[model samples]
Target: MAKSSRKANSGAFSRRKLLQGASAGIAASLLTPSGSSWSQSAQSERGSASAQRLAAITPESLPKAWSREEIQRRWRAVRQKMKEAELDCLLVCQHHPGEMISERQDGDADIEYLTGISLPYKWVVLPIEGKVTAISTNQVKGAREEKLSQDRGIDVRIVDGPWSASIIDAMREASVAQGRIGVTDLADASRQAEGEVTYTTYDRVLKAFPQAKFQPASYLIDGVAALHSPEEIGVLEKTTQVGELGLQAMFEAARPGVVQRVVWLAMFNAMVNASGERPFSVSVRADGPGNSALNRPLEEVIRAGQVLSQECSGCVLGYGSQVNHSVVVGSPVPADWDAAAKDSLDTFEEMLAAIAPGKMVKEICAAYDRRLVARGEKPGALVIHSGGLGTLPRGGSAGAVGQIVLQAGMVFDVKPAFRLKTGGTAQFGDSVVVTENGARRLGRREMKVVKLS
Candidate 1:
């Protein structure tokens, strides 16, 4: 969910302040990877003032249980795509941070997904016939240890100066500086449609390798990345559990007159304590049924009868899972709310029925629209989007990337929403994975709106 800003009183500390202070401790505990994977060199590097500052600028590499087999599987899949595309190499890069991790300016998913390094300012040059190389703005000593622990090998280097200059060096070292190279960015046609590579980087690459031909090949990565491996599926399943825990905590904390930030704090603690990573996928808003969706949590007090609609997510490693809930503050639950909940669930089931291997994504949207049409109700945007490494393959609708075929390993955060007759929105979402037979929901809770009394 996109974040919205609101003004708040920056005054004396309260329980909210205490809770906020404790969040750093919770984050440290949650991010401390299970074993001793950090190399002594990495620790020494971080010990320096300059190195520590550089580390602060880069995204932290979370503990991922991906095996050498999984890494090899990805390499093979990407190589095959290169062969099909007749490209000599791939310049897989992420130049900007996502909206979710804007505070940290975190790295994009493609860099982390392909190579295990998760630095915000990094680039990877993968050749069809040579070695894979990574260029980082800061040293990632733990990255080497983590990859070695998994028995995976990769060449990692630091960029002393210009990003494009370092990238050009990496390209030359891989022997693809002047080859027919394919360039990819953080963009995906399904959601973030704009390319992330800066004009400066592109221009320098072109200038350095005038003979080289470069083409947009984001599809090569996106196509292969759309499907998850068995290991990936397991990680996603656990992430969903973490998301559920956060949602439950948020719901339990919401009551009449409670500040929205208080509710957000409860959710933040629950997720971080569950070994999840930021940016925690969460959105909270307390409004009447007729109001527009609020993408961020406000400091307003919760009132009786206002609906608290929120989306909670848990991210483990780099995979994230989300679940949404709409709670009525003090209820005689409105009939409109009741009807919307039932409608969302019914439409979700319909979408699930259409989520089979070889089925186009449009079929899911069609199912959603059809169900609402039959209900004679106004339909909201189909809230189903691909759930995988960093915001790739956002929701596909009948009009957007709907032709993409469904596969067994593809995951989706499906939540069918509808507008209430009185004015607000009602929806329920759960992370689900497509199976050989059909689709299975990852959440353990019952699908319904909570009526707080």
Candidate 2:
């Protein structure tokens, strides 16, 4: 992910100055604010300090993938989900780099999760009774990444000539051209907004396999992948600890006179240096003085009484865990805002307590929403959301009352950014997992507003 940017090396690198054009993650096309639906990315300025200073390339191996039996076990879980959906085979698509919300690096975890292989320009085809294949453009480019997955015992190959042609051949070889097939990125015939699959490619696939029953299978892939296995949870727990270390680094780096981006910059090496080689993603942006929620760095000099808010996460072997916080620069915290943040933390605790096997999604949502309302603060968009791959899926729609029940091993993220009586948002949260008893916190850090300066 750390390719050199020709433009970003102009002069003295000022973290705050990069805010004017720090690389923007995930354009509006891939995701709109009204809802986190798929869309495209925006044009980002090159030569940002992040691209040069905090590129997330590491040399380490924390993921000794599950054993061969375990890989088959997970594959069976995929088939079970497919059986429930009546799909004979599932075609999982990769996300455009523009679809990810990250600081500088982007990844495709859905593909990685299913095949245990993480390669770009690739597709994973999983048929009920055949070998699951990781389809890539070429063997040379992904040789290193391919070896990593091969070490874990998975089949990896390169598509000859056109990718569509290769895909058609693969399906025909498995005799699935005329059978039911599921493509995750197949947009509905109407809007058909360009996501990872362009209209031309979508039409080409349809034309190539005229009689195949192609359908959208994103829900099946996302829903089941959202639930973590025992081995997956073990990796996520390690990811959470790495995130805690990054947050701790951010806390230690925050002080009077420190640049806004310094907090984020500090996390770059601190995470990699400390964690060795766990797959991790870190993003920290300050909102005090010259910095907005969307912009990072801002070169804004930190002063007393300003708050630094951020959404930082990391993945151990591509199993993601995240945490959000708003740290105060100095004392005499605003009572109204403090109360709201405290209530946010309190509601988060309520959410963790409420998540248990067999509980309806709406039941847990309402249980926490009511607690926030009683405290005179409306619960934010998502009280709880699901975790998978490298992305955090907001479990269905936040505040959408529903009967979707929580089962053991389901993992979700909790981030509360509520309207404050004193103004602005009071944001804080962390990741958790649903076990037989209740939601267990994955992060190692304490749930309290930090006082750095």
Candidate 3:
């Protein structure tokens, strides 16, 4: 269940304050881990769980994605920010809809955050003083994408042409031919543009509208997309809950003689089918006396002396949470394996304890130092992370630039691992939402390993 754009446009807003239709391709890749982790010689993280209560409720079980009021509230907030910035229109170019797994920088999900519907590719035009509209050359599933946009009250119009022309159409529909335009590839302040709005898109848009003043608006868009509304928090909660199903599936199925891919598919399929999630991808790896290559698959086979770890995200309405855990396949546990897991688990707990509304991300990350140092260990690895609404920090903790304070509505995945004396990583993590009181655990996935029969 990947969180890429689905559904297409039927009869909606036209190019010039009228009605027309648009047309598609696959989606871009999702987030790529940056900074600290790649440099560390330690092991990586990703995985999921089982069935039971998860099947009882799902995104499909609930008909509505966001209330009309919720969408409007979001619009109003963006508009106000636009007014403050003196921007007449904000043009957003998101990746086309479809699942892809390139090693490069994946596209952003700002469009998904703004509109309930995620399209394959979009040239969304948001006006500060007029009607908000979106134009796309990428036609999604008409029945699904179109209906969702209509239901969400978004003035989305499908058009056929170059991606740049889609921007021209959306601008004209909103009657914004010339004004100050804020251009963003939907990246936050911390990272360079990774979405579809590359130099070509921007240059094309610039030539199409020479009269308009254009400026980098990532900071502005990030401002609006930064904090999570209560409704968003609730959506994340569901993703974490569903992630539990996949996590359970992984733990239950991880055993000697099991196919590694089958174990992954068990968790992957569980999240998609049971929770109605659109998972992008998951990483599963195993290590032991004879197994070592981190990214290579295990030939779909699990063995007794292996340590298996997985990193996965269960997404609900484009909101997702990560669950990372490692297990010893069977019996006579290897020396210090469980201890490494315990240390990571304890470090996660330390992060939670350090989280508060006024705390900086670095301060929250200090828990890694405290726990690791107490264990006579040092963390040269990234221990804590945060992400939501297509806004995820690459590498390190919440403060990629080192100034992010813990806000009540922020969601994060704390993956804390200790360097194993046996030459690998013992890692654990899960997604959580920050609360006024502290960090509220959204994922109920098992942190400690349990024996599987």
Candidate 4:
């Protein structure tokens, strides 16, 4: 996350003086909104600042961008696996077939990773041994395909009307006569499935394609999820920086008599203005006691001496990074607050230390439980405390918060939190990469509670 500092206050000013001071600050090159202009000297200074910020992000430090050769190799691997599993072909849907709101479209991550196309109104049919074809809405013809397939050189077929005919035609062109065709859609089997052919989409694929087979494209999804290239890391780092800016704004807005939504709006505006991006999710909550730590920010009025927790995540180029921090308004923390924050920090450090490539997730969870027990605290049942970080495309469960084995190239948001018996809680999280030696924190700033008195 990015470092934050307080904006200097120009106090005891009359209305006229306040306006004059504002104009003077702009004229004197003391302040400039992000991406704004000033005198030539100020512009040069801002340019230097930009350069320094860019220099901090080492190009060689992040993972490599996926090459066409690499993508093709992985695709061939999946095709070979499909052949071994006796599956005819895999059908990946771009949008959800069901009209139900809960059954939304498939994640764009998997489709983009595979075809370099990241639209919701598209579909792809990757046969075991044939050309890959995409069926998309006619309106998106030329533009969407051109942008998505700029690198991979894949052509997307435009569908004028219903998707069923377009899908069937593509399947026939791939020579999928009577074999089972794997599909990502669960509701649209008859639309894509042909006579004497088994529909291999989701659970029913096995039953639909008895002679053929049904296999999920999970391995392909997992490969993309685990793989983190250099460009992706840069985007994620920027996202973390945006999150930090939001956190800082939250701290600044957390004062006595400020409504919760007002604080949220301030933080939201700060982040959007700073990065020109919106947070994936932003929530704020403040109360005295008997509240869940994950409380959503409501329209409740803020009172003096209340603890406010602000959690935010920014979406940059589709990837996201999240951070949460608690702030005190108009009062110093109680005696127990310091100890709880310290213990939370300690637990976070322990978790970070335990994170390494090749470590079993189960072992890490066990270690967390042991540490909490040693601290004379009840270890809440936490299945997974970390995960591979990236844009969540589709196929996997939405918000799949769970434990998985650590890999060398994977990035994780390692968060270890504990609730105090006194009805208060302490929490902190940071983004880290699992390297061959150990984990590295992307946000180098120290984690601490901000007490605004």
Candidate 5:
């Protein structure tokens, strides 16, 4: 189990600006007639801003595109899931960043994983049989849509109004206006409870398609998305390599007299230079002798005997892996601190041993708890959530969902968090994938407490 209190960094690609684009689209809807498209003037304003920003990076310069085979595999999996759910189509919303808890930095992982595009306020209409159309609010002269079509080889439709109206238009075009439609925002385990769609948007959708029966179908995608393909696993390995570099940079920069913020920036620069995109949360806990809380870098200088408890991850192509490590600045190491730290690593190893294919979710959690007890330590919350595209299943244990049989190709972020009687804390874990034999670590860092003299 890996537990964390993650913070969000909107990324260098201003997610707030993307939200503003969504707002602009919504505001444009008010200016237009109830059943009509956006006004010409309103479109020009929105398009210009997006176009200018997109001009900096050419399609050739973009990160390696997903293979056609991988796309087909994902489509087949999702369609099979849809078939099981007895749905005519899926209205998968791809909107503003940080909208979902698990997807705070990376925008909608479902769309990004499926279409390989990271644009905001877009809605994808995937029919049971036919072309998949992605409706975008910021398309000028079909240039943006055309670019997407050329890149992802999917149909791109330019919507001139809010996502609610746009989705209705797309559904009608796909001939699923009155069919069984599955909306993504309904309920995603842990990430979303009542769904991510606002009341206004859902109400508008309900009013437009009164005949269509809508159901919460986020699980349909969530289940399929959790199992990564071979291509995705390769990408995850590369992403973990980049995250390791960031961790190394953090360790090098952390020393007596250096501000915690400077150390964090050092890690950020190293990861970005290594082709990293979204940088997830990094907590630098150097409070005192018994540090248990995670926090952002402050102006306080690092003291000689202070213990630094840190957790961080670096994102690449919308994929990231986490690493939690701790260090003592100048050690005459405390025996109790060293013992607790080693026990955390031991607990993590035991948990990993129990994470093979066909294992039950409760079994893994039970193994984790038993190991802590064997060490004469009180068991604490452990997090063993899926790590893929970001918005996958999340929970204190295997998942918020009930007993699930572990399968090969499932990736998990397993961390065993330990809070000792001395008020000190230690969390040891890494990103791992379930294989036929056992779990494999994606982290390159050594799992142990470091003592710096």
Candidate 6:
């Protein structure tokens, strides 16, 4: 039987409230059966078979894994880039030493890659010639560092002092006095230097050793961002699989008079029950008019003729992958919707085909513009969104929305969207990797609007 919509407490729905409500809806859906006869038959069979079940399994158990060698190889590449940049040492800090924000920073993968440790409020120093030391605020235990160092065959050091002092001391110990040291402080490092009297912590480090020159580490970071190791690929692939499965579950859970939160919960449950790692974001939308793009699922009940657009991400082994799809309930796909989705997919595929090593990013953007114009769509600001998907350090750069020059080993999510003449929009996206010859789709499924009526 179709489940009735859950009543809402009186208030405007914020994103958090929507998520909370959706979680409840999802729980309810799992407990209720669909009205379909096949569903009822399956329920009956499941009830009969329950007595023959085996031992229960816990999904929280992570698989025994080995990626130390892979991480080491990536670090070697990063070290090489540091050498090319003429850096004496590279410092990767998680949060500002004294002022820690509750929110996490986005680029911890780089630090995690260099050191086989995953924690915030830490600093990783990769000297051009010497050992790599991971300095932190004594929050990490000595035994953990020893195990990580032993597993990766690298030195991991724990410093017991203020963050700035530890950083300075590590540099001094590494003999980084007279050469250029690369710092990832894209902000506040300069002012932290007390004028010429005493340079900021970064400046102080340079002053403490007059021969050391301080330089921005963006280029070196970019270099590491461009490459991916095989182990990283494995993590990314697993994440993609998780995303696909979660999406399927969300689609199966959607129905008329069902709440949008129910579909979102179904997706989340799939990820959690599959033992997928943390850092997943799932969003679901129903067919509506104005401000629908920004509309998260609310207490409003889903109708039979609505379209559900779902975007989901799964992060496993510290790598992330995303998948998006639209599902229709009890209605044929609209002609305009079909055309818009097909054209978007076609444009995305064309962009993927154009990716190759050594192609200019600007040229790729221009091609995308030309193609969109030919298809009767206006190409606005084009940005390249391509990079490595790995637990190790990865970077993404903007290219044309329609086209981006490809580089071998670069993985990307090509999602091209267009504003439809009607009251809605269309979008399709897929993950692909650039190879020596061309691009390869990570997931084999064709880009199309899926109807589940």
TM-score of each: 0.80, 0.76, 0.78, 0.67, 0.78, 0.72
Local distance difference test, each candidate = 0.65, 0.57, 0.60, 0.52, 0.61, 0.53
Superior candidate under TM-score, 2 versus 6 = 2
Candidate 1 lowest-lDDT run of ten: 1-10
Q: Which segments of candidate 1 are over 4 A away from where they belong?
A: 1-64, 95-105, 139-151, 186-192, 288-295, 374-380
Give the per-residue lDDT digits (tens) of candidate 2, residues 1-453.
Answer: 111111212344322223212322211111112211101110011122322222232223344343445556677888898888778888766753223244213355557667654346367778877877777766434354565456545556676666666566667777887888888756531112344665665677789889889887666655667677777776666666666655655665665677866666655444544344332455554442111333244476766555666656664445556777777655445556677677678767776777789987766766456756676655434556455564334542244324567788877677766654434456777878889888888766567665553
Best by lDDT: 1
Top TM-score: which candidate number?
1
How would you encode candidate 3's per-residue C-alpha lDDT over 365-396 as one tens digit per residue?
77676766777765334655455653555345
Which lDDT value does model 1 have at 198? Answer: 79
Q: After TM-score superposition, what is the CA distance of residue 415 in candidate 1 from its true location, in Å?
A: 0.4
- What digit string (tens of lDDT, one per residue) describes model 6 on residues 1-453? 111122222344322233334454544456344544123333343243321120011122222233566656766787898877777788775422112211112335456556645444366777876677776555554444345455566555566654667777778888877778777644433122211112355555565767667766644654565565555555555556566656656655776767766666666765644433442446667663312433244576767655666456555544556566655555544556766667666777777777678775544455456656776766543334342323222122332222334457766565565444433446566666667787666654446555554
TM-score of 3: 0.78
Q: What TM-score number comes out for model 6?
A: 0.72
* Minimal lDDT window, size 10, model 4: 393-402
- Put down candidate 4 lDDT per residue, 107-202, tens digits, no spaces: 444455566433444667788876777666755554523444544545477777756666667766776767866655333221122211223323
* Model 5 spans > 4 angstroms off: 1-63, 95-103, 139-149, 287-296, 374-380, 396-402, 420-424
Backbone atom clashes (below 3 Å) for every candidate: 4, 10, 37, 5, 4, 13
lDDT of 1: 0.65
Query: Which regions in candidate 4 have their CA more than 4 angstroms from the true location?
Result: 1-88, 94-107, 115-118, 138-146, 185-212, 287-297, 332-335, 374-380, 383-403, 421-424
| Stretch of 10 with least lDDT, candidate 5 | 1-10
